[model samples]
Target: MGTFKIEGGHQLKGKIQPQGAKNEALQILCAVLLTPELVTINNIPDIIDVNKLINLLKKLGVKVENIGKGSYTFQADEVNLEYLESDAFKIDGRGLRGSIMIVGPLLARFGKGYIPKPGGDKIGRRRLDTHFEGLINLGAKFRYSKEDQFYGVEAEYLTGTYMLLEEASVTGTANIVMAAVLARGTTTIYNAACEPYLQQLCKMLNRMGAKISGVGSNMLIIEGVKALGGTEHRMLPDMIEIGSWIGLAAMTKSELTITNVSWDDLGVIPSVFRKLGITVEKQGDDIHIPAHTNGYEIQSYIDGSILTISDAPWPGFTPDLLSIILVVATQARGSVLIHQKMFESRLFFVDKLIDMGAKIILCDPHRATVIGHDFKSTLKATTMTSPDIRAGVSLLIAALSAKGTSTIQNIEQIDRGYENIDSRLRAIGAKIERVD
Candidate 1:
């Protein structure tokens, strides 16, 4: 396992650019299989999960070429359908959760799609029923193998229909839309996830000759096209990474500028950070965070009640950044409650922060109460292990603001999302190094 050795209590300055959105890259890569023409994608982040999916595409006979820095062109004209039954494919497909999305495109273009049970963060139960159920609603026959833990969907021809999703799942909505684009009739999806990434996917499909409307709305309408053509797409900057950098600047009392962040797309992120007393200033397309020399204070309700930050669907705060918020609140001037509504085990990392002498209460599996140290007390460094991607970055931020050196194990979790994180931090005067 790789590790990170960090020297704490150092202030970082200079500018950092957020990488391509990891969530959007996964969806856009899977959508490449929907067309036979050349699809050129720019701003592809060089991360483990995204690279794994690209390798899987190559093994399936998709012709892929690296055109430039963070740019790739893919053509899936001669996909190897037979490879899906191989033992090698079973092992490769089980490496990441994003592999599940390939099934929708394959089933839509070809006649069949198969995938092994995917593996990802051990945060909680992320069921695949939403994906399969959505495909089944589009006239596809679904089958599952209990002994092998594999899922398969097949159909001679799919006919579109209306569907109201039980939950507004991002991946599920993306999967079903990819399939419905090639169906026989109009498909209307109500209660669809309107995340900017999903909206990007829908807009990209429209550019590829698929008829889709209602961009950036909860309801989507897709009209089946005979075939889709090639189109170019550029991914947006990762908002989650941008949020992490904001928290990092506040926690370490540094002045850092995050460049090229899509300000309008970052819904409620800036406001939520401001609620924690951090300065998120907009200087054109970039976000400039000044040093919090006196520490920040959490805001209370209009009725003078304690502040509670919770995650919900789009237009609400993202659950992925809750870990960063919890870590940043440790040194703020007042208290805040972080309610992680989507995943159960995401809050379990608080014990490690508590070990570092931060005042935190693990209210339960879904909530945590943070009592800010207000910079009067500095966190003492300690050795720890990373449990997941978000938690790993949160711990790294905590270590950077701590009083001494700290060692973090299993940094592969951190590498899964962020691209060249240590080098990026080093350029901004951070004392972080990768150790093998």
Candidate 2:
């Protein structure tokens, strides 16, 4: 396991540009399989998870060309469907949770798609029911093999129908939409995840000749086409990373500017941080967070109730940043409740923050109450392990604001999401180094 040795108590400066949206890149890369022509994608994040998916695509015989940094052209004209049955594919498909998305496009075009049970962060149980059920609604057959922990779907022809999802799962919505794009008739999805990334996916599909409407709403209507053609697409900035950078600036009392942050798509993120008494200034498309020298404060409800921040569907605060908010609150002037309703074990990382001297009360598996220290006491640096991607970055933020050097092991979890995090932070005056 690699480690990050960070020396805390230094304020970071300079501007950092957020990488391309990792979530969007995953879905877009899978969508490339729907067409046999060249599909050019720009601003792809060079994170571990995305790289894994790219390599997996190469193994499946997609002709991938790296035209430039963060740009790639993919042509799936000669996809080796036989590779799906190989043991190597079983192992490769299991290495990435995003690998499950490839099944949708594969099943749509090739009549069959198979994947080993996908692997990702151990935050909670992420069920594939939404994806499979949506496909089944479109007249696909699903099967599972408990012995090999594999899943497969097949359809000689898919007929579109309406589906009201049980949950607004982002990846689930993307997978079903990709499958539905090539179906025989019209398809309507209700309660679909309408996050910016999903909207980008829908728009990209439309550019590829698929007739999809309601680009930014919970209800999406897709008219099936005979075949999709290749098209170029550019990904949005990673909002989760942008949120993390904002939290990092406040905790370290730093003046930092995040550039080109697609402000309109960042629905509730800026306002949510503003609720924490942090100044999220809008300079064109950039977000400028000034040094919180006097320390930021948490805002209470007008009715004098302790402010509560929770996750919901699009236009709501993302659960991915709840850990960042919780960490940022540790140094704020007031108290706030963080409810991580999406995952049961995400809040368990608060114990690591407690060990670092933050005043946090883990109310339950899904909730935590944080009482701010207002920078009256600096966190004491110590050794810790990264539990997951978001929590790992949250702990790294805490370490950067601590009084001394800290060691964070299992940093691979962080790399799965963030692109060259240590190097990027160092460029902006952060005292962090990677120890391989």
Candidate 3:
């Protein structure tokens, strides 16, 4: 376990580049199992979750190699199905929610797939029923083991058909897509998750000979093929990371230029942040934030009311970024409501901010109202522990801009998403140190 000892009240300056999308990279890595040929992926973020997924793939006899900096090559030509039943495999299943996606591809290629209850942010009841239901709809059989707390699936031949997901679960949508790619017939998925991450997965699958239509919309049409060949694909830049960086710059009143942020993919992030009064300049694929000349003002709707920022499925404000947005709102001029509809416990982290002299009203488990003091760096830092990926990073950002020295324990939670965040923040002029 490692901790971050950060000295706050420092401005983050200079230019930094956003790494590959962690969410996209995880799904694309699993997409490698859809092909037996050599598949090389570029712009891979060397994050903890990605490495864990790579290790899981290697254990299943997939040849994965770190060919270069931020690049990886995988060949699943000899994937052994036995590893799916191993206890070692089940132990790592809960590492990230993306691990559940492997179940679909493995079951499609082989006849069976086994995974323990997949783990991710303990925000709410993230049910795998949606995932299993979609697979079962495609002629897959499943059993549950209460003793081991694991789930298993088997299928003879997947005959795809029209399926409607119970909810727009991101991982569930990716799982079905992987399974349907090699199925016997066309699979139509409605109410799919069309986030940028899933979009990249669909595009990469298409490049490898998988016929998928409705790339950007909720309806996905996948024409099953016999097998898919390998192709070189590059992951998209991390929009979540870029959004976090933008929030960091605005909160600290620092000038920064984030490079290689696929501007086309960041559909609603810019406009949402702009609603909070953050001025952003887009030059090509790079985003520039100029030291926030006029401090951010609390956004309001046209009805002369304080603005409300909430998350929905794709094309809405991402649930993963609500924490960063909530923290940034603490320094805005007025009040805005931050509603995290997807998770129940995500708003609990606001207690730390309230302790820092920020006025926050915890409306419920899923909602909070933040009245920004525009506090002049008066947050007196104290000891805190990271809860999850997004909340942990938000805490780090808050600690960096706090008044005194703050110690954050269990920084590994932050590493799962943001790659080498301490080093990256240090490069951009943040006064933070790592202690093991």
Q: Per-residue lDDT of 171-287 in model 3, one digit per residue for the tens?
A: 899999999999998999999999988998999899999999999899999999998999999989998999999999988889999998989999899999999899989988899
- Which residue window of length 10 is worst by lDDT in model 3? 371-380
lDDT: worst 10-residue window of model 2: 311-320
The total number of steric clashes, by the backbone 3 Å criterion, in model 1 comes to 0
Number of backbone-clashing residue pairs for each candidate, in the order shown: 0, 0, 1
Span of ten consecutive residues with least summed lDDT in model 1: 125-134
- Model 1 C-alpha lDDT versus the unseen true structure: 0.96
TM-scores for all candidates: the values are: 0.99, 0.99, 0.98
lDDT of each: 0.96, 0.96, 0.89
Runs of candidate 1 exceeding 4 Å displacement: none
Compose the digit string of candidate 1's lDDT tens values, residues 1-436: 9999999999999999999999999999999999999999999999999999999999999999999999999999999999999999999999999999999999999978999999999999998888889899999999999999999999998888999999999999999999999999999999999999999999999999999998799999999999999999999999999999999999999999999999999999999999999999999999999999988999999998889999998978899999999999999988999999999899999999999999999999999999999999999999999999999999999999998999999999999999999999999999999999
**Full-model lDDT, candidate 2:** 0.96
